[model samples]
Target: MQNSDSDFFGRQGDEKILYVVRPHPLATTAALIKIYIISLAIFFVLVVLGSQIRVVSSIFYVGLQQIPEHLPGMR
Candidate 1:
């Protein structure tokens, strides 16, 4: 026979409500703002750096040089 006095999910005797820990509202807000500002600053820096650079890859050039013969200019 199932005990009617037992808590749901079968926990027995210690039927006390669990105390949940919660952070202060002001502190959480301040932390989120700080993170957002730091990320914005980093994003701007990367954008500025990307604008001042041109990326080139030599891999395609090397691959073209290695093409097999009897394929016209590859001879």
Candidate 2:
């Protein structure tokens, strides 16, 4: 009787330095699709966050520049 580990852990016999895995076409396609979707979503989120940071930094810089230079201490 074949042990269930073969199916559970993939084909098992001997460990090779480099081995090829031939998965089902549908499985490969589905996995690639999911990776692409997740990567795209992450890319979009980063873009939005970067835009928000840029806006906030610009506002902070402008406010700092607007501060009065003539404080009544070291004059």
Candidate 3:
């Protein structure tokens, strides 16, 4: 596979070097599937992390709000 990319295969079909991720589009289908799978996993992980952060922050805020109740002079 030469790096010149004269008649590269594209996602649509054979194209003339418009853009070349790979020299042959034969691997495009598998590559796209892999990319989708990886992205989905990352998305789910991020969602879970965000929810956990929200829960923790809410608990911290609630603790702060209850501090005045424990103070003798502030009551």
lDDT values for all models:
0.70, 0.65, 0.63
Q: What is the C-alpha RMSD of each candidate to the true structure, in Å?
A: 10.6, 11.3, 11.1
Tell me the tens digit of each residue's lDDT in model 1 across 1-75: 453433345565767646545688999999999999999999999999998875545763666656456555423
Provide the clashing-pair count of each candidate structure. Answer: 0, 0, 0
Those runs of model 1 whose alpha carbons end farther than 4 Å from true positions after fitting are 1-23, 59-75
Worst 10 residues of 2 by lDDT: 1-10
lDDT of 1: 0.70
> Which lDDT value does model 3 have at 75?
26
Q: Give the lDDT of residue 46 in candidate 2.
A: 97
lDDT per residue, candidate 3, 24-70, as tens digits? Answer: 67588888999999999999999998877633346546666564555
Give the Å error, residue 25, model 3. Answer: 5.2
Cα displacement (Å) at residue 35, model 2: 0.3
The TM-score values for the models, in the order shown, are 0.46, 0.43, 0.40
Task: Encode model 2's per-residue lDDT on 1-75: one tens digit a residue.
Answer: 453433434555675436446688999899999999999999999999887763334654666655356743322
Better of 1 and 2 by TM-score: 1
Error of 2 at 64 (Å): 11
